[model samples]
Structure formats: C-alpha cells, structure tokens
Target: MSTETPAVRVTDLTVAYGELPVLWDIDMDVPAGKLMAIMGPNGAGKTTLIKAILGLVPPAAGRVEIHGGLYRDQRHLVGYVPQRGSVDWDFPTTVLDVVMMGRYGALGWFKRPGKRERDQALTALDKVGMADFRARQISQLSGGQQQRVFLARALVQDAQVYFMDEPFQGVDARTELAIVDLLKELRTLGRTVIVVHHDLQTVRDYFDWITLLNVRRIAGGPVDEVFTSENLKLAYGGRVEFLQRQAPCDPPPDAPDLGSYPGRIRP
Candidate 1:
C-alpha cells in the first residue's frame, strides 16, 4: 500500500433527487486505514453519500476527491458492496461467477478475466470463508452467506478504499462476527473501510470513527466522543418518540393492534 494521503475528501457536498435536497453542506475528511461508520436514522442520506462518492449518483454541488485527486482519476482505487437488498438473488449465477464480476471494472470494455482473475476471486472467497460454496448457486445461500459472497466480490477488486452499505443487516451473529474480523484485517493492511451501519448498540464496539447524519450531518468524530446522547437525540429525537407509539417494521400477522396507540396507523 502506498499510504500517500487521505483516503477521501468531500467539500460542500449537497445531493438532491429531482430538485429535492437530501444532503446539504457536507464537508468531510476521511483518512486512510481506519474503519469509519456512517450512522444515521432511516432516510438520512447515508446511502446517498456513499453513492455520490462512487459516482453512481451525481452531486448537486460541491466536490469529492479520492486519494488526493478527482474521483474519475481514482475510480479504480475504490470498491463497493451495496446493500444486499439492492441485488436480485433470483439471478442465475454461481458464487464464483458473481465474485469474478468485480474484476470486470479492471478488465475494462472488451477484455475477459483469465486464470489470474479466477485466482484472485478464489482468494477473496477464501478470505471470507466462502471458498467451499464458490461453485454453489448464489440464490441457494442464506442471507449471511450471500452477504459474505458480496464482500468477497468487493475484496476481489483489490481496491484501497472499500465502501459497504448495510452489510450486516439480516445476518446472523456468527456472520456478523466474521465480518468484523475481516474488517479488522483490512484495517491492518492499511485499507480504508467505510460502512453504513444502523445498530446503535454495537456502533461503539465496531467503528473507530462515526458520522452521525439525519438528512443533514450532526457530528462526526471518534465514537467515544461523537456518539453522545445529544447526537443520538439529533438523529432520532422526533422519530423515536413517534415510532415508540407505533409498531416495529413489518409487524407479524397476529401482533398487537396498532390502532390501540393514539397516533396514526396505516391500513
């Protein structure tokens, strides 16, 4: 690893979709070799921020610099693992096949992956403890297994900066532990790992730095310093109280009557 400079730099970043602003006046500096977590409530623009950095979503204003250069200039140096729900599990593909796709960006327009690419994919799968399932159909895997495959796919990219969104969601405790260990190894190798995480209880244990966002950024710094009651209040102040009187997401069929609460409940 070259370790030349900061992994990512954002200045006055504002993102909008069809004229509706989602993020505003965002300025951040992320150094290399740290595990940084983007923490926020639902609809807080965490995913939008990641997409903007990856060039998947264009920013309305401000600039993004990667490795001390323009985004396009450093595109190859970044890897991404989007939320698992964003992918189609029904797609006909083997685990190895999907992992090999990560090499496509490097192979470019017309080139095909060869033995070296296959080897790299296999190595990535091994790192995530999914090498035995490489030949299996991706659709047949469990949620955690599928997540591991996606992580393997990103690892195959061999990028210095990795952006993962909700990788731990819907995963088992064992799988979550495995992922944290993998992230630790990546940090040891001087790679910058940025993750969008939701679980407030484990935020302090898993991340070195935290960025608290709620449509707008509240505070961002080390977990011990930034993950305060005030910041949590800013992130979920109104929604928490509102949601308390409501049912959790996707309530069960025989669950309590939501109408029993005082507030509104959708049919």
Candidate 2:
C-alpha cells in the first residue's frame, strides 16, 4: 500500500530444529501487492518459513527483512494467519474475542483494547463476512467459518503484509472461493499476501508467484516459469506421481494385480 520496497526479503536463510536442518539456503524477495504461494510436501518447512519471518521461531542462519528493515522494527505492518489446527478452538472464547486479539500486538504490552479497537475488530469481522457470527463461540462455527474468523483476526491488524498458512485446508467450495476472492482483493489494495497452499490444482489461478521448497530451495519465481511438471516432481517427492496414477479417470496400471511384487502375497 505504501510506496516502499519489498514487504519481505529472506537471504541465505537456514533453519534447524535442534541439529536437523529444515530449510537450507533460502533466498526470496516478495514485493508489496503480490499474492505469493508457497507449495511443498509435508515437512518441507513451509510453515517454518512463515514462523521464522514472523520472529516466532529463530533461524540459525540468514536474515528476514520486512519493508527494507528487520521484521521486529516493522511488526505492525505484518500479520499472520496460522493454520486452524494450530489453535485450540474449543477454548472458551467468542469470535469477537479472537478478532480483538489482533489489536493486542498494536496496543503494546499491558495495554487493554478500548472502544476504537473493538470497532476495528468488528470492521475486520465484517470484511470476512463474519460480523453476524461475532457473538458466537468459535467452537460453534463450521471449519470454514472458523477459518474466516481467523482471517478476520489477522485483518484486524491492518498490516501491509499478510502471511496465511493453508487458509483453504478443509474448506468447502464456497468458503474457498470467498477466501480466494478476499486474497485477490487484498493484493488489489496493494498489500502483499503470502499463502502456504496445499491444493496443487488451483496454483495457477490463485497466485502470481510460486516458491517451491523441499528441505531446500527447489525453485521460485513467476508461476508460469517455475511451476512446471519437472519442478513439481522435485517439490512433491514422488507423492504427486502416486496421486496422478490414482485419479478417477486414470486408474493404477496394476490395480488388478496388486500382489505382483515378489514379497506381496495375494489373498
């Protein structure tokens, strides 16, 4: 939104859990107003990258910069929507209570949210079409509804860069479309949105830039240039092959002879 440099920059980034390296030598730059998608197989460190950028997790190597500065210096300009599975939805909290939490970071430590914060939270809920469900308990909402509620929580931050981790996971078609449209609108408004996505089928339609990770940097750039089948094979680690072979229109070649392997016994 602001006439500034890139919203995120990671150079020679490396992260490790104890001695095991998760991300290696990652270098990326995300400009403002771009909808960037990150895709990789499970355990490829997609969420780690997001968490490291948010300063929630420490990276053993490299730097994360936001708006040409360290992320901490620009924390107010960055918002994060973690996976729905990350939180305990059953916690006794109302939807409005969750959305209001976004304002806490801005209000500084020890500061309570006031009427202005409540109004902003409500507006954010409305933005995600969850205003009517404000008073409802988070656990009472559907999975899609909960996802939108989390998104509204992030929206209340009013950040310039939003990092969403699998915002579409388990969501129905309508909810998926609504969230997708909301992300598109964010990009149009000049905010940078980076999403960790799992659905490979809609990559082209949802994102302009794609970053493929596989315990290492596989490829990253415009989707048209980097999202090739070869690159996907490298990113998915043969799992994509299994999915392709199992498609409804194209059954496995040896379906009738499932026990053909030397060690496999036919019943």
Against the true structure, whose lDDT is highest?
A: 2
lDDT by candidate, in order shown = 0.84, 0.85
Q: What's the distance in Å from true for residue 130, model 2?
A: 1.3
Write the residue-wise lDDT of candidate 1 on 170-240 in tens digits: 89889998999999899999899999987665666688888888778888877778877667778766433
Q: Against the correct fold, how does model 1 do in TM-score? A: 0.87
Those runs of model 2 whose alpha carbons end farther than 4 Å from true positions after fitting are: 1-4, 239-267
Determine which window of 10 residues in candidate 1 has minimal summed lDDT: 258-267
- Clashing pairs for predicted structure model 1, backbone only: none
Candidate 1: residue 21 Cα off by (Å): 0.9
Query: Candidate 2 at 194: error in angstroms?
Result: 0.5
- What lDDT, from 0 to 1, does candidate 1 have? 0.84
lDDT of 2 by residue, 94-187 (tens): 9999999999999999999899999998998998899999999889999999999999998888899999999998888899889999999999
